[model samples]
Target: MPASRNKKNLQVQRSDHTTIWYTVSGPAEGPTLVLIHGWACNRGDFDAVTDHLPANYRVLAIDLAEHGESRSTRDVWTMEEFARDVAAVLEAESVDTAVVAGHSLGGAVAVEVGRLLPDNVSHVVALDSLTYLSLFPAQSQEQTAAMVHMFREDFAAGVRGLVEGGSPAGFDSALKNSYFEKMVAVRQPAGLRSIEGLVHWDMDAALRETKQPITVFAVRAFATQEAIDRYGDRFDIVLVDLGSHHFPVEAPEGTAKLLASVTTE
Candidate 1:
């Protein structure tokens, strides 16, 4: 394993009255790589991945408001609002340009971030995200209602269902349980509201407005043909054999390589 470098933790306040927490590492002059963690996950998820990245790449791992060390009192937990949290961090760090990469829900937020700051964001990368039909493509009112109803009725069961749904066949039972426990324990109100926000998010509209090149590293097991057909022309969907939806955690070096591939191009 590559030796990890020193990381500087920082915080910035966004216009929406949310405090954003982030970590910075690597060379100051290196090309910036902004990492966004998945729903209910914090920036710490990328700690090992950052170590595997080239020392010349400036890395910024951010905690979306109400996730990780960041906190927010705002009622709106939409993807656009989450993107604003990222935008605020970039502004605070004075990052002129970057390759914004996100996992799961963070992937939707990355697209929003690119849309929100087209001038500053050169490329948008999605890791095991945006491939799930239920989570992307803007759900119908009836679909959204049913999904939200399930979560509202039994949040723990709903979260466990999500974990089970994402885990590949024959995956380690212990690992699956660990993931379930962490995700199920997400901070209240934000956790539930964020799911609601994702269900209601208009990904098609966002894609139409955002003009950045999107590279999706989708887990082969979960990459549906419908999603590929719908987004194939728009996004470069690369089917990967990495472990589960949380491949970055399981294969940080491979994930780092995928992320670095676009940054160098």
Candidate 2:
């Protein structure tokens, strides 16, 4: 089949005012893939990557509550609650089986989804996520407090720190600035609360519970040996030089190829 060309903007109501905005493309009966974006990012980040995916695959890229077009008034921002957002979409679509892929924070959510719907999710894919030794693993009480304090006290600085962390040496200043701007402008409360939720999450417990195969596509330059050494047995970490942490947007075709290789397997 030719590459998927038709895209539909859709949403599923989670509550009276809460709804998840998403896009659906490709065949309904095709192998399913659910794409979730990172913190402060919307489903739009995967627009190009979705365009590059094989036509035979069904793609659903979602905006988590309060991110992108999704709206909500609920205060909870835990990873498990975010997983429920993805689950609602899957249930709405009547998806029987799927390979769930997420970028950054979404990768954490993907792991939760695997645990949440073990019977439905066949595999879990993390894009430039789970490699950060400081962020992916569960943190000590003091560590979590320190991280959350940074964001609460100076949110922009915290967001800038994230942008800087993802960028490699000699990366374009303009591009880095663009990412920083977009991410720092994320909706308030949820932005800070989500970071708190992420820092407090127990990834070790989630990984232990999720029984599906897991793969991580990490930036070669930024990926650390320690992370690989630590998670080597748990995840199939493949490194690539695909421009910064936001490779899905920076190198859509390459990202698509990487995802295709995994989904096909």
Maximum-lDDT candidate: 2
Could you report the Cα RMSD, in angstroms, for every candidate shown? 0.9, 1.5
lDDT of 1 by residue, 1-265 (tens): 7998789999998766688899999887899999999988889989999999998999999999899999999999999999999998999989999999999999999999999998999999999988788878799999999999999999999998988888999998898888888898899899999999999999999999999999999999999999999899999999999798888998999999999998999
Q: Residue by residue across 67-179, what tens digits does model 2's lDDT show? A: 99998899899999999999999999999999999999999999999999999999999999999989979999899899999998999999999999999999999999999
Q: In model 1, state the lDDT of residue 52.
A: 95
Per-candidate clashes, comma-separated: 0, 0
Q: What would the TM-score be for candidate 2 when compared with the true structure?
A: 0.98
Residue 29 error, candidate 1, Å: 1.1
What's the TM-score of every candidate structure?
0.98, 0.98
Instruction: Locate the minimum summed-lDDT window of 10 residues in model 2.
Output: 1-10
Candidate 1, superposed: residue stretches over 4 Å from native: none
lDDT assessment of candidate 2:
0.94
